[model samples]
Target chain A: MTSRERAEGPGDGIPGRAEGTGDGTPGRGERADAGVPERGERADVGVPGRAPVIERRLHPVTPLRRAWAPLAVLAGWAVHDPNAAQEQLARLTDTMLLLGIAVLVPAAGLYGFLSWWFTHYAVTDTELRIRTGLLFRRTAHIRLERVQAVDVSRPLLARVAGVAKLRIDVVGTDDKDELAFLSEREARALRAELLARAAGFAPETAREVGEAPAHVLLRVPPRELARSLVLTGATWGSLCAALVVPTLLWLFTENVWTVLVTALPLLGTAGASSVGRFVTEFDWTVSESPDGLRIDRGLLDRAHETVPPGRVQTVRIVEPLLWRWRGWVRVELDVAGSDNSVLVPVAPRAVAEAVLARVLPGASVPAGLSPVPRRARWCVPVWWRGHRLAVTGPVFAARSGLLCRRLSLVPHAKVQSVRLTQGPWERRWGLADVHVDTGAGKTVTARLRDAGEAGRLLAEQAERSRTGRRDAPPDRWMTAR
Target chain B: METGSLDGTGAPADQPVWRRLEPGLLRVRRLLLAVWAGVFAVAAGLLPGLFAGPAWAACALLPLVCAATCWRLLERNWRSWRYAERADDLLISRGVLWREETVVPYGRMQLVEVTSGPLERRFGLATVQLHTAAAATDATIPGLDPAEAERLRDRLTELGEARSAGL
Candidate 1:
């Protein structure tokens, strides 16, 4: 499944080898001159130092897959208004209707085909270069070391077509580059290749280690996931709104249809979100691999996400109100460059802690967090007991919220800044909140602490972050090994 | 001077040397507030005067009251803005009603930008912004002398490169 051997198939082009003199070309002469020490390992795997550059276009079925949505809409529009369709047909004659279909179908196909043809991606020795766009030739060369994670998502339409989309998340960038509509096999192979390279392995050894089978750690049952989704605050809030708004409207307007209309949208949104979450997290499974923790989920879309080591900025464990009775909680990760942060959609507390230990290496959610000062009760009358903080050797953990208890942990090495904030009321009470910021855009805040304690925490956390970063492991994990 | 040391050394000499924003910023803020107040006063006076009656022109006094209140508050807000340069991190404390103190370590600094708008340039003031990997660290020191702003930018950049760590 190595990219070099797979590129020999039809429709795949090795422009680097064909042209023989392009930029960053891994030619035989250069491979010999640039003698990396891993050459012997490459020979053991039957592959030499640097593999030939693998460059290929998107799947040929991409055009039809891309045009299907608009085609479906057109057909629906024509069937929806039969009178308008007949009137238009009568005005233009049956030949004109046929002519319009002939022109539109091919036009859409041609545009899709042209865009697909223009797009090409190449995996080089140092970087993965994606050259896209027609009129504006935009090329993104993401360095291999900066590649954070690779996600493969299969939308329903693309899944039916037996193709998938690959999203590459790079460090320090907000937008992810995607290669849409590749054969499922090809996408998986490409993803493994990218991950292996990002882990600092030579192409030959990358194939050997990348293809190693991962151990399945945990899988959430479909019933448990649906139960957890229903138990969320959002679901309960929307359910209450759906019932109350219609009742209030019925009292005022006294119109059944008006009440029905208002209630339908509210009920529909709540139902759709619940069903969407269930579908997206149906077969949620977390696996432990040498590269990192791999999450494979989805009933319909089927997304495979990898959270590489050192990329997670923070971890959040949420125990919703109802889930507390069932002793289930959801673990979310603030991973750099990836938005799908759910480590475990729903798991027991013990299971979640095990998974957390795997992802963060040495960090865990502390059981005994120091509660806020008693004076804080003036500000948060009810929830002051829930707000607590703990500073451990590897991570800083903060707990907040009474109804839905949230425990957020930020690794000391990953802390970006520390802040202390005091409001007017807090000033009177001599209380402040300490916030620990990370690159993942989540802050772990210790709320309603003594002003002096907050100041000391802020200063100590800064110093800990400095020493933590100094003692942290190297970014390139495989190279360090 | 705040007598507490942010370094946790508990030494008086180690206490942070807090520096205040330039006094010129007060004048600049006052002038800008006056300009907005004038515009609002005209709009309030003319719009209602034309629509309702000439008697509604008295509504223009509302903006004057608000502007005067803000004028007095601006002085305290300006006085509240102060920053301290520590051995390892930069501390910025500001806000009148809500006191916010931010500590940005030198190793975490990604980019330091010096910007001066038209009005700020006219008043000989520049703003220095420090960016880290985290977006929540909104650390900005506004209303500094141009030379000091430049010096800060250069020093921060040099320190950032020397101590930069991977995110």
Candidate 2:
């Protein structure tokens, strides 16, 4: 009748649950094994039922976390110009801080304790409930069946303390209500348990872990990283000047020691940021597990994100002008999760094509699937050409990839709005900017060097969009109007 | 949903013989903006003395400051003026430098709102904002007489709901 017996049931292939405390009643520890439902006659019914016990655990951010703040205050006192006794008093203050670490720390601990007390969460077999607040409490219950993905994450400090946060995303749940964190071991156990339980809900039986496709790991070489650094500088040159100029002015008023203490960190951060961005921004890997793909990267702390195939809405291939020569491309996927899109920051254009083909194979391109005037094509001409040309047929045409180029075919159904805009120089040169919105969530646009062509493109796309909506059910008021 | 030559201007074919700009209405708006500009100029001239430290700076900035207020009032008057009804949608163009033309299809309109501010009421004018599902695309026609604003609201409401209902 326990979770162990349920795992042993023929319907599920997951490992048996750990034993609960020897008492008949489920203990706090048993609640740690909260989601593993016992074997039941309902196993054939395929409904995930609850485990007998649940536990409440505090977040690991305790009073001991504030040890540095008071130490900082003592450090400030030590540097102040004062008599010998006064200076000694400052030194004595450090010892006092250490002694009061018992009482003072717990006083600060009260804030964290209240925060933990105010937060409450429970994960049963069927659903997860979180309730927290000081004045106006909020309670959110998410059905486990609707969960799209669960992200378990921890910063370096939290990892040292062996605790991590859990963020579970469901299709329709609001952003704030979908996240909860448990300790590191507990989070892993909970994730495994939840994934295992979700497996029972699958219409087909569960397969072994390695049954999924092998993951493709791709890393950008150091040369490519250096190139990315140069590109990042070009893109953010103005922004860098804005931050550095102010700090340089501030350094003059400070003492030599003070300037060194502050400016060193600032300089170090800038250097690290440039290097980290180069290291992390474009290094991409795609690994497939039974659950879904795990995409991991970052400059400081690594992020491992799992995206199930069922939640994917659209796939986009992006190619910016700077990376064009290198044949580098980036791929992002729109999925139903807390973060709307998954960024594959950097990939070789060739590698990206293979990945996109695997994830979204034969998905009809939105632009090319329609007839003329129903789809739009946007084009920017080369320098050698006299003018840019944008042509819209019953097809949507777009360029894809970051470094190299590939043509993207978006269909008419995806086109939302068409716009034509021209500025002073553009008008002088008879050029216009054209943008098209697609149902795929954001604006996809192309600028044409020629105004006349831009107008035609706009008109054709607008016409296509109108025709696509013509078959929609008529409103009741049309006759009366 | 189709982009056309409507441009929020009434169809050139449907103009009424007497629908030209009313001289009385135009004079009233111009007078209001003129008075507003005078009041802003006076306030700008006086504010510098209220603060300390080389108060000449505020005095020097007053005319440039007054220019902004004058321009804003004049621009509002310009944008609030409207001139259009076409076959499919009601066209309204408003705004000063950043002129905007909005088309509200009789079928797409959810409701018509008629509102009057203190200044508008004193001028015997009211503003009407037509509501639609595409929130950003709503049409607002301002600077109409109370009588005409009400009439337009009713006409738009009747046409909108009827078109919405497919009656």
Candidate 3:
């Protein structure tokens, strides 16, 4: 069966596969039965089983997709410097120009083609092995059980070419393995299979796991996204600097050109960044599937990110000063191994809370957090009142920032370490600060507590973390179920 | 020195028995400081002497005085450094004026490294660095006997593996 599929061939010259392998091929005979056959049979449906050894190269359009960036850059440079282009063209004869194009274009294409040809990925029962590199010859074997998350991202060029890239993030590793330029449907299928395998599912049920029905939880409209972006502190700060600084300069120097020159770039940068956020976060949707939370976002470069169960390290709910009036807040999750961590770009307070509840069950931002000691006001006079913290049964939460209120939550099971620090001034005031760290960079810090209270909290939190880990579900969540 | 015992626990097991860094660390530190002080004193005296007169060579006294002050400060700082091995976690306390106490659980340890630089090796000293998933965790116990450092690494690694929990 594997040889037959191999003979069927890859890079079929079609930019994308229409439909060779849809679903429901019981290739379970070759499956290595690790365990849990009962649950596998119950859950397995419409899943295309994997052969004993499945190996294939990336799509044919990968070369073209890879070449698009440099070609576009060259075109942009030529357009920007028309005089330079014309001068260079005039110096060369027609034959020389043709020869140059012939040599350069093929050379670039050949390089892309060779790199693509050398890249081969294979999936066995236990691991996904990728072999690439033309000269050095490197091979990466990622254990299926260690797969953390699989992301399918389509940049503008790849989207146009009807292909996508699959980025595989594994446990305890910073580097991501990527399979560049697969047909969109194939990428989705592969992602599902990999995630299922990671979750300890049999090969017969892996494909169906990807097709599990998802319920839409929240969707941010384009209008709300625009309004939220405009209200952000960065936008306001940039606007004020662009307008106020230049106006002051004009008043002092009385030069209109200088003001224009100074303000243009600042205004351009601010406007560009805001628009970039808008483009990236457009049509942001959060949906809950059996596998995990599915975040499908972006306009120009669509990305489908799956945050598997038990992977969220911390959740942050931020309400900017201006956003408070509109009752809008942004919810961000510190998901392990994923950079696009914004769970919801903008939502109402209640909606954001609801989404948080979905992401981290039995967790919420508690009301009436214990405020810092009054004497600690010497450190941060204005924001000390807002620096509050609470320890719930499931999570430890800290609230800070008077101008922009932020509530950071870390699950007890996710606490990596605890720290209690006291500066000279804080010690003088008989106060200390407590920090609860997670795998992600964000930490929940309870600042300016009584030193004794801080010590007790540290000990209690360590105990809680121990119990939490003892009771926490295993990495293979499906098997536990 | 037992400033922050949790819950005022009376049990000796509950109370952390803090251990101080090796006394040899102070000697190594003083030697390192002396070398730096000599280099700075020479630069101060020679640079000004080249531009001005030999009278400016008195500036050499400035680094010596500063080094003297730091010599006392280094002892206090070194004395301030201490660590305790608890049931589930390790507690490291340091800093003279601004005290910091870090609690890292065995389950959270990702890597533990034992390293000895040339000077440290010359003095037969090593440092044990503990790493967790959190990058903010700066847990280092400097200036231990080389044999002790290895033992700590092995014991920590064993505990970490036994209690390993995913992030």
Candidate 3 residue A135 Cα shift, in angstroms, is 1.2
lDDT of 3 by residue, A157-221 (tens): 78988999998766433342588889998898888788778777887767676765789999999
Per-residue accuracy of model 2 over A1-481 as CA lDDT, tens digit each = 0011110122111111121122222332323333434421111112235333343444546333445687787677755654764756667666686887778767766866675666665555545656566566666665554455667666566667766667676644555553434566666666655554453433222212213344655555556666655665343554465467556756666556655666566655676657656545534456766556666665445455665543343456666667767777667765444473645566677787666655543443333321212111323223212212223433455543323443443444334335555654455556555555443334444543356666666555655644533443221111121
Model 1 lDDT, residue B124, Cα: 91
2 versus 3: better TM-score goes to? 3
Q: Interface Cα RMSD for all candidates?
A: 14.6, 19.9, 15.6
Model 3 docking category: acceptable
Candidate number achieving the greatest TM-score relative to the actual structure: 3
Q: lDDT of all predictions, in order shown?
A: 0.79, 0.51, 0.79
Candidate 2 achieves a global lDDT of 0.51
**TM-score of every model?**
0.84, 0.54, 0.86
Candidate 3, residue A299: lDDT: 97
Higher-ranked by DockQ: 2 or 3: 3
Which wins on TM-score, candidate 1 or candidate 3?
3
